[model samples]
Target: MELNYVISITDRDQIQELAALFQSLELNMGLAMLGKGTATSEQLSIYGLSNTEKAIVSTVADGESARQLFRAAKRKLFMDIPGNGIMLTVPIKSVGGGRTLAYLTGNKTPAGGAPDMNFEHELIIAVLNEGYSDAVMDAARTAGAGGGTVLHARGTGTKQAEKFFGVSLAEEKDILYIVATAQQKAAIMTAINKTTGAGTKAGAICFSLPVSQVIGLRKMDDN
Candidate 1:
């Protein structure tokens, strides 16, 4: 089945509520990270941001479930209120390998013949050892990536990840987010992998998600 990534950036105190909401919706796979909003004093005042500390919640859901979750979040989390938060979804091209895919999809693949390719933009996400966001960004920039957002996170492992990736995983993590055109996604990911991949202290894993819409980013001609 096709998947979409639902991301919510909201007040730190509201994270638990959203986590419970996701659980109620049966979207078992989720992650939360700590971050600080990058608004100036004037901007914060304009947006009514009393606090800058933020929690970023991410999860995977089917299209229908994603729509339901977004609607529920807007009402329950007060996302319509200024400075409350923002929610967005990015379509996933594919997820997991053979056996892993089976486990993730419960052995039932979507009836679509094969995944289609009509998206123009992608969100490149890189999760790495803590404090390596700058390094990742530098690498990405060299490969045509522009500015990105960084979030402080912690990783939990059910299995020994060191055995699988040949590098010890760090509980403290940093997630770097870069949005680029589809043509630049591969190059950006390749740069990140080379400098921060398993062999490095960063132990980074990079992936991309299709972006179906963009609002704030400026048009190329405008730049």
Candidate 2:
């Protein structure tokens, strides 16, 4: 089974509705909301963080259940809505346990495909300004970053981003998420800063996590 990791773009005020939407789909609200996305400054617009009002991230079931949720979302909410985010899915191979899988998918009937509970590498999560994913990715390559996922996004905030390192700001942005080894994090971040530091549009903030488990990545193996 596969999972749809829907990063629903919207504003903080709209979180309730988004939450309700997820609840309706019986999906898990993974890290559902940004820690401090309400304020423009906290929104991190160097990468166009200002263009995004807020985002609601969730993982939903696949197969019939996934299809049902998408149909419902399209019929009920994804129309004429300005700034509504995009929905995409990544396949999960297996889970740590039935309970863990249920929590991750919000109890949606599993097609028996959750993320594998065992893996050799760590998964890094980098949240940064948009429009600079290219630069970030280049840096990651230099830093021994195995590879990464790039998602285009609009960072919110018109007033908060007056001058980041003495530069005017834009209202939209992009985000590059990379999963790298524990040893390579430093090089990747350094490479990204070289391009986006004070003069470029891709300035970013990066962080990482140890992968408890993962699945479906023959491509990752070649790396």
Q: Highest lDDT among the candidates is held by which one?
A: 1
Write down the lDDT of every candidate, Cα atoms only. Answer: 0.72, 0.52
Model 1 scores a C-alpha lDDT of 0.72
User: Per-residue lDDT tens digits of candidate 2, residues 25-134?
Assistant: 66655445452222224324433445344454555465555566556656666622322433334445556898876787667674544555343445545545655565
lDDT of 1 at 131: 82
Instruction: Give per-candidate clash totals.
Output: 0, 22
lDDT tens readout by residue for model 1, 1-223: 6667777777789888889888888776779887755454664576564645777788877766777787777678767554566666686667668776555444556655334546788878888888878778888878977556678777775456777766554488887777788998999999989987778977889888777643333335534
C-alpha TM-scores of all predictions: 0.56, 0.43
Alpha-carbon deviation at 43 in model 2, angstroms: 18
